[model samples]
Target: DIEIHVHPFALSYCSHGYRPQEVLPFTGSMGPFFNVFCATIVSLSLWRIRNPKLLPLLMWAGTAYIAEGVAMFIDIAGLPILTDWGKVIIIGGVSPVIIGILGIIFVTIGSIFMLLLMPLENVSHRDSFGKKYLITTSISFYFLLSVIYTSIFVLFVLDNRLIAFFSSIVFSLLLTTIYNPIFPFLDRLSHTKTFQIGWSEVKIALGSAFGIVIIVLVFF
Candidate 1:
């Protein structure tokens, strides 16, 4: 399972020592929704790697995605920079820990893959796949976030709509800004097409595990 440790801030606000499940249980409504939601987000992040052309738009939209993921991750674990190794730097590149060890690996591999497929220049012939995928995926992310955010707004009206909305905004900004600097380093790794071959299969395996978790959560 995805073990999460909560932030200290939550402890001050809520009377309990922070725990992942208490803050965001992956069962009931959140189970199925997050299952579908994170899968889409993962697919979106893998954009340029899958089709070299779509890098621009996918990266543009990834800004928001990186924010959402990081924001929630922070709300859970505070500054994840405290993770093992503190920080990692290399002769050729660097990786800032955005969430945890897994996050570092995900972005690292993604950057390598995307960088491999990077265009030598702004070549026009390579634009078709990029444009088509971006349009389709961005629209999908928007649709899902829109419905999810709006529902959170309406359903939680009795409690704290303001925090919820602000949380969404923070999430948007966090996802975008966090990934921008990291991409270049990943590019430097120079593992584009080959990275995708391994990463995609891993994604499929992880996704299967996620689906089973969701099913178990919902039923058991």
Candidate 2:
């Protein structure tokens, strides 16, 4: 007999010939652990050895990776909570509630650190860098926002996670190209101190907002 099982998190159904007697091992947790570990190492390495002139770029890259890792961890750990309606829960023999709490703490700290670091790095290095850096940074932030929005939308609508992930990435890249025409305006605006400072702050704020949105989506 074909047994139909609905996945609460994915909001999709699958079929199996027979119910397995043994509990299947969840290998999903490994991806987040790997992401966190690699990102931490890369961030630390960039801070220690990267050129001072590239401070803003390095800081942005480092913080982005760290945030991504933390987001992934929260998403994976929170899946069980969505499936079962209970305050007390366990997944893979560990309490995902605890993992979710820790993920929140890490995200909070990381966001605050990024908020402080982005503006300071931009202001400090403004004189050394040129219009290229400013334009690049602006476009990078825009691209990131596009990716996040697209990924979330696609993941919700599509049943296949891998296909949704890659499709979002491709579509995000196409969407970001729409901003190419504004590059000239951004380059001109880069000459002003006020605009630079304001842009830096805005970018960091949006970044933090996206992180929070991801966490909320995963949990709720």
Q: Where is model 1 more than 4 Å wrong at Cα?
A: 1-69, 72-146, 149-154, 157-184, 194-216
lDDT of candidates 1 onward, in order: 0.38, 0.44
Error of 1 at 55 (Å): 16
Model 2, residue 69: C-alpha shift (Å): 7.0
Taking every candidate in turn, the Cα RMSD to the unseen true structure, in Å, is: 12.8, 14.0
TM-score of 2: 0.38
* lDDT (tens digit, per residue) of candidate 2 on 1-220: 6543422224333376775555434543443455456655655566544333434444453454444435545455456553321122344555665656766666544443332233334433233334323432543454455456445764554434444345434533432343245434443533222223456555665576566556645653
TM-score for all predictions? 0.28, 0.38
lDDT of 2 at 110: 46
In model 2, which range of ten residues has the least summed lDDT?
82-91
Q: Please give, for residues 1-220, the per-residue lDDT of candidate 1 as tens digits.
A: 4344322111111243544543222222233235335644765676535642344333433333333333333433533343222222111123434334544444343333323333322222234544323332432353454446545554443233345345544443443343335546655553343223345544654466456545644544
